[model samples]
Target: MSNEKRPYKGGHGKPGHAGKPGNGKFSQGNSNQGSGQGEGGAKRKRRRRSGSGAGVNEQNRQQSQNSQRTQNQRSQGRPQKWDDNSRGDKKRFENRGENRNDSRAESRTGRRFDGLTSVERAARRAKTEHDDTKRGGGGTSQRNKSGHERNRRSMSAREFSAAAPSARSRTADTARATVFEVLRSVAESDAYANLVLPKAIRSHRLDHRDAGFATELTYGTLRHQGTYDAILRHCVDRPLEKVGTTTLIVLRMGVHQLLNMRVPAHAALNQSVSLAREKIGAGPASFINAVLRRVSERTPDEWYELIIEDAKDDTERMALLASHPAWIVRSMRQALVAHGRPATEIEQLLEADNLAPVVNLVALPGLGSLDEAREQGAVDGELVEGSALYASGDLARLESVREGTVRAQDAGSQLVARALAAAPLDGTDTAWLDLCAGPGGKAALLGAIGVQRGASLVANEAAPHRAQLVESSMRPLPEDSYTVLTGDGRQIRETLRKNASALPGSIEPGQLFDRVMVDVPCSGLGALRRRPEARWRKSPRDIAELLPLQRQLLDAAIEATRPGGVIAYVTCSPHAAETQNIVAEVLESGAVSLLDSAAALREVALHTEGANGESVSVLAGEKDPGHTPEIKVKKGAPAVKAAENPTTAQLWPHVHGTDAMFLALLRKN
Candidate 1:
């Protein structure tokens, strides 16, 4: 909230003013000055001398000649060409030693005003005044009377150009300004805040602390977007949709600062108002200021109480209090019941999604080492192997990360990939497939392991841009070890056959991969802590649209796996429609059977290291031979009834310190 105010350049120092006519004051001998005269006539005046004797007259004449010589000496080569010899003009020029302001003006424009008419002098003077204003001269500036303004001089011209009335729109450059841009991008372009924010911060050159602040403001505002919009609708006279995207984004960020962050009310309001004035129009900014002022009148908890006082049901009340959509609250409740957990945990689940998650990084096996990461203040992950948790600084600064040997991956994601690699398989296990690999985190880890095992992998992405990301992630591996395919994951059988002939290595028609991972895209509800903007972007319709794709990708994986090979069905979500329901639908086809996924995870977890480099266990001896222990649950926690098919594992952030990742291992029959 840098209140580094800039002076308004009104009337003076405007471009395109050079040749324009001006009021005829101070026109003198310059023709550029328009035709007007002041108290004295527009002519040079001579003063009379008091002399009686002839000798005194002679002395006066000598003095007059001496004065002319002095005037000539004062004019220098860059002479004052104006015929302004009046008393006032002489006084003004005497103060302007060595033709100070006029000389500089002449030097800049390559023209001497002494030879010009009054009108032309007026034009040059106007232009000089304009240039002075641009250089922060002779203009009234607004200043914060409270504390010293930090970064006052560092504030770039573009930062305040919106308020300054520029010829072009300017981008915001402060942390809060970056947050506003990200929010506006989310609303206007349907961009993900998490994806859009980092670039904005980098582009603004925000320091580490400012970058962190920007991240928090962006994620927090998006996390509570529903509640903010509801509150804004109450405050505004019109429907919230009628508000422009820029104003709405500014108001949301303002409300977040006022309610969630410890920023002072004035600081929040002023910063948001300033940002609005800089980004949007003055009218919209005034509206935002008024609405945000009303919003700041009450505490967040008081507003919550007011908002939920008339809730129709407990779910609705919970939704308002926790700032989650009613449908999602109900869905999470149902998911809790489906997984044999207490439905009451839904409240806690809702709260957890609002909190930020620690950044998790995976050091790819063989190619990635953990010692360097540990030296850089990163600790080992709590629930996944070779993963590190670093809460501060740029992760890209790490050499391993820069070299593509390690990456910022979720602990839950790392576990699923390792589970597939750790799962016992019979027959040749040389080929692998990531059916929907895009922005390929898991693919890189798996590719590193593929190189370790002397195997080959195909990382297939449905989009070209994402396929490029997959290629970038797999750069550490030999070019031949992994291939990135761009096509629909649903067409894997045909797509693989088409590429087999030209693809390097043993990949060809009729060759089923030893391991196939169908990490289908879903609502992304589970990873909300990491991607706070997702909570606002998703809806019930998203789940409906995704189910078919999820089913198709899983079915394709089944078709693309060898008879004895294992397929890991994964999602960063716990919705039954996406997880159990989709898996159940594919299993009904009778071509594949479920394996003990929980057991596979247990075996993998045994090798997983905690932050202290100790073997992290879900519980003591949970991986004992011939035994599959249940996940530890509360005493009142409902027991999950074992299904006929092998158990699937659902990891929760509150319980597992990972994203709410769902994993199911299936083997071809």
Candidate 2:
């Protein structure tokens, strides 16, 4: 048997390049690492060159520094203002729960949802009526008194009615109006629908049903915008750029409901027209009505087939029919080929992106109990230990989540963190590092695991505000077991190698950690289902730009790892350029050697059990047993090949029921 065998359908790795670690820079030798700016020097200089120079630039820079200072001061105990420069950064803040107001300190009331839609209001009314029906014994006066008490606890009905925009008078219009605002924000400011939708749901007090509707409308419209735009091109007399962004958003929402949602064509049309008339004037409303009427003339399947009929090639046809940009389809195809999987999986991958991902949560080991969560309606996640999949109920209502125990974490993320901690170590295995610990989901899990192992973890995030979030997440763990640092990860190896004061008690001065997790920043293409707006926001240039930083971060992680210890190079991306390419580049440089990451993950899965300690079996071959993706597996493929070691693993949404996470375990020589 040869070493050329693949481990699983989507896992592969190469032996790393043979070289001694110098300074953690990408350059081979005589390296002088740049200052502790988050990104590479070349990238920063490129950004500076794009800006105005000298006096104005210097003045603007000073203002930015001052603003950051004020933000840090305000976010001392809270999550900081979002990073305006990158959508990925904004998402990190949102994931860390830093974007919301201080939960333990601030009141949810008084934060009004000013643009309440009619549909949202109706849902609330129906819920209240149902409650009244359940309490049928109450007399009229008694019921009135009870209603007054409820109003005192929350916003009164009159106040809630007044809070909604006057134009949105219909009871069933709330979700549509909410979708419009979120879509408008995404169009104007590149805000993420996933992040914005939750806040809107909370502020508007949308019940579970209404929230689900808004989510479907928002994600569906954004995901299928390309196909809808193609349809609109044939219908509209003017270019989309000429149409107002608001009107276009409304039209897209109406089109989505008409084509994809269970909503009736007439209801979709009438509600959309009403929305346009209320928000933009009757003239645009008439245009919307005409366009939507034309859109509803055919079913979704018929429309998609017709739209792609004139396509010159299969790729273009798939791109249009699947509602993905052609460039994304191409990139995904290349990514699949590069990762050793059949390139034919791109269609299934793109289709998977359009589908909603299941909500995954992790019960922080020792601090939270998965059994408690399961009792509260969460089903045990089949893949990883201390993980559950729950869809309904407010997460904050759960005691473990509210009290800072279990957190909403993707199973892929939990797997990677656990793999890093559980990787075989020699001698002392008491110190660890999370190099890019933003919003600290992995760090929280690591911290919990560290407590069990009698180890300490140093969680480092470049952004000050994000570091604060890491601190908050790790707060439940023993204080002496972890330390949160606000510094650049690229500087970690040098900083710790020179002076141990940087990380304090987590690691002795000048001593490397036993395990390091380099969850490097990337284009985040793997999590498209969770972050629906991200697919449209990312570009090819993003992958190109991120490659250098990823390489440097991986090098830094290698430099920071003890010789016998291991480093987990993880990314929430399946893009070949950002995942395998980065790993291959580092391996070619000879700084470290690859471990059997697939076997390590298998070990993690095998050892990870339920609350009773019975071994939990995890299947990676297919996501849903009944609905396995139609893969074009070649003939003569082995069901389970042995004697070949694969050092990397790529988890996919369609295959593993997780984000397309890439993990590579490399041990420093």
Candidate 3:
């Protein structure tokens, strides 16, 4: 198969010019090895270059040293992209997360999403609405030697001219010489992964393979940061806290390559160390090398065993291996366990997150049927039964995607929409509303499906600019099938239902959608991999801050649907407060009725009796009919399955091989 046979996708050990390793000033055998400072003739050259007389030229030498250090501030990488020198060394490592002013024992908060194995993760979450501090990197030099060293250090103008910048510096490991830097910047500054990675890769001019490598490296380093830091601490001599930010990140990049990456240990070490010596200065290189070598001495198993030995329980073990913080693992484990998953599944869930996600695309329903799109060159069809094609390449690169005939939607989102519109259709246009449709991935798919099945869709969005996205989402469909409106959907619904209100509604009676999709905006915790920087950017507190907004959005969605209309409450989060609690509150309010998804998906899969042996999230029968997603369940399943529901809450890249999405289908009584 081209996927496996593709030359570029080869793993480590496949033939390539993997570079040489360990490039320090002094080492064995190589011609240039052991040829620099501290070697036999070095003191004589220093004295000779020191020059017999010291005066104006001596003062000139001091200024020169300061100038060279300052010039590096504007190197080609992200922390500072363009170079305009004659400043202090403080400008170079600004994004390194190692600010001298910041507290060394700063509060550890951004780690709550690590997917731990207990409910403690939830109750432990505190609000992160505190003083936000930007990273002040590169204010000091790595070679300052002493922590008490001055923030700005420069000698007089009489210093030496021969003291030039190191020769080992080059572009970078990515297609673009500066992609890694860009990645670090996004993580430190923007906290946007989807926005940055592609831009960096494209700018670097790397092919698909190299782009993949850069992408993996960026995310992997972020994901396993805790473990990497431990290994890095083992390798570097000085306290890592004292290390300059830029150099520390460089070491982190190197450590990732050494431990988890497939790149040969030598290539990883040499290139990284060389970059370090030049970027950071001399002393750190040998220190970096010593640390890396010691870390490399252990196999992955040995490392896992060692790290996990410290974990006293399943939560700790899963957190360590899966690269999640204990709190996150604990919270998710609770939500998942209620959905019938085991605690051990937490590790598997985390591992799955680190793997590259298969791209999924939805064939816009009315614009092009899945079958028609497959015929039009959508490859990898029929991989997952309901899914037509496994998205490859930049789906956005396809004119079809740009033209809005197909969209890059997670299958989980597809299923959520499907579950919302899943009921037996009575061959006439049923009004459907996709509330909050912006940059419209799901809205477009919903529009397409609604169009195909004799239904009309009203896409309501909060932002006018984003409302255009709703229009763009429906661009491929026929004009009469949908309309895009900008307004708070909840208010719009209330006005329509009000007895004495003069508020204009986007639609009149009979125009109300039979199904409403509230793909409510949440903390977006589910999309960590694609959004590498989000890991560093999010605090456990972001969740609580979003609760009110989530509640309002859910209320809006609930109000928009007509009686007997289905409403699909969806979020990328599997969080209980966001998922079940939201729905449970609605149930308590007695506004609408919960409908059985099994009945909605009766055309797809469900089983009441155990006709064969199979494991379902909730298999409540003696005869398990060995159900699959493809099997159409013909019996009853409730919208709310009490504590005994068979939903895995639709986890991603794990169960459906897509993003984690929660789905609850409710029908108005």
Candidate 4:
């Protein structure tokens, strides 16, 4: 060899001779050793050799030989010295060939091998690996653990139900289920518990005892929801809003049973947790269990003290303690003072709102009798005539109730309707009107009384559905005794004026009613005891919104009455704006004058004694001799004597055990 290196010839070593396996360098060929060329000539010769078919065939042969050698070494259980490098080179050659085929296939089909795109392939591979890991086929211990966690997280509904509390744990009580369904309906669909509860009780076929239990549980839970939420906030780790609604309702029921009812702590906890697991999920059930455990650590009184400890004032403290909104507390206090009641009674009133009201029933005066109800252990009402207090069970069991001869009516409502019927009117008092009489509890009583007085009643409701209810309520009475009209109460005067001849009754054309009952729509703050959830639903804005309509309806009532006719303005609320203020504004028109409503209520209460001769005294202020004078003024010349208490009557839940119904009797002048 010359001092300068000769240009390389193409081959591993000499033509047709393989290089020594461990040399790590190719052998030089003798074909162009003497006729030497420069580097350029060597490059051109190498390119030509690489592009030739012989070179490709040689590469394939070398790869096959390497694979065969490796296989033979593995089969014979002998380690090959040069196995790593040879195997790697062979794999690279195979991969390159595969890449070319893959490129062509993808270009033609727009997909990779296995008929899947890249994204699809990735997803399929991941799923396959997950399945393998789940089956304990091939994965690390960490991956297997993660797979188990995922499986647990994605458990089916049936599996979760199976994992719930045992069936033998007294968790499937029908009464509790009924209560839960009612609460869920109220929370989810904004349905009234009074409307949904009875139907649910019927559908569940609950007995009298179970019905009573369900009633108490549902009302107690709703009444104390605010207080329970306060206590739950103390027990829970996060805000209550973050909790699921169904879970929160379950917790509320549980708390009510624990603190308010006679239920044992263990029973309450297990039943509530069971309900959660049954209705909600196992995870939420666990959360409820943990929280309820924390709640059971303290007594209800202790929780009350702790929760009210941070109150900024008496109103807020009472709001938390009595389970009422703070604004409602303040409004109640204002209402007490405005309605001639002492402001100190707000606490009693709020506590009363939490108490479940008794089902008050009224027998339609002449056409209905209380014999059926009395035979079934019903006691006479203490607030109004022809009314009874039913505490036994579902009122549906009473034949009179089913016959519409006796209907469920609040005592306050009975008092107002009776007062309106008893109100003195000049000339013939034979024609009456019950404006805004929907779902006709009052209308039924008034119509029955009217039939006895030889009077015809026209019950008007704004909604067609409610008008039907009014008609249904009066079905027990003679069909000719009352007529149900579906129309706006505000337009009653005009409608009558336009169609006076078409009116149903022994009335002359263009004749107005002798008595008109404007039991106007109101915020229903007065009936909170009967509708516990209403406390949370109402706001001051609701009263404000109803003001104009109330005034209009009252005005219409006055206009629709004869000059000497009596108009009874009634509301199931004691809010000043909805009651006294509305009466005052309508009175300012000088078309009507306020009468002694308190005296009328007292008269009605006196004539209507309970079966045991007990009666509720509805008189307040100086009108009531038992009233202790809270404010005393020295006999002086220039003192305004507490603006001589308005003659309007207001029934109180705490005082009379009736809804805080407001009544203002007016006479068209």
Ranking by lDDT: 4, 1, 2, 3
Q: lDDT of candidate 2 vs native?
A: 0.73
Kindly report which residue stretches of model 4 are placed more than 4 angstroms away from their true locations once superposed.
1-171, 497-502, 607-646
Give per-residue CA lDDT, model 2, range 468-531, as digits (tens): 9898999898777888877778998664554466454646877888899999998898888888
Predicted model with the maximum TM-score: 4
TM-score of predicted structure 2: 0.69
Candidate 1 lDDT over residue span 1-669, tens digit each: 011111122221112121223432222222223333332323211111232434544554554555575578677755544443444445644766556767886898787647688899888887676466455553344344454332112223232322234312433448887887787778768888767886887788889999889988988888888888877877886677656666778888889999999899998887877787777644456567889999999988788878877889999988877778898899888877666567888888888888888888888788878777889888877666787888766676688888988788888888889889988899998899999999899999888888889888899999999999999999988888888898899998888788876454856666889999889988998998877767767889989998888887888888889888899999999887887777776665566667777767776763546789886566224222112223333344333434343677777776677888888888887
User: Which residue pairs show backbone clashes in model 4?
Assistant: 13-27
Candidate 3 on 122-222: residue-level lDDT in tens?
A: 43432121111101122234343555443222222321111213323442344323545665576457646566676766666777687777767777777
Q: What is the TM-score of each candidate against the true structure?
A: 0.71, 0.69, 0.64, 0.72
Model 3 CA deviation exceeding 4 Å by range: 1-163, 166-169, 173-178, 237-245, 274-294, 369-392, 424-429, 463-469, 494-506, 509-511, 532-536, 598-649
Q: In order, how many clashes per candidate?
A: 16, 13, 45, 1
**Local distance difference test, each candidate:** 0.74, 0.73, 0.57, 0.78
Which is the winner by lDDT between candidate 1 and candidate 3? 1
Please provide, for model 4 over 1-669, each residue's C-alpha lDDT reduced to its tens digit, 9 standing for 90 to 100: 222234434433225322323344444544344333557657755775676745865775686687677689889999765756586665665687788788988898886647577799888876676566445344223323335422223224332433323332435578888898899889878889999999999999998888889999999999999999999999976589867677788899999998999999999998887787667665567668889999999998899999998999998999999999999999889888887779998888898898888888888877778888788888887656677877777888877788898888888889889989887667989888999999999888888888887888888899998889888998898877777887899999666666565566676666788999999999999888878899888888888889999998988888889887899999998887787777766655566667777777887774434568875453533334121112332343233322234377888889888898888888777
Model 4: lDDT of residue 237: 60
RMSD of 1: 16.5
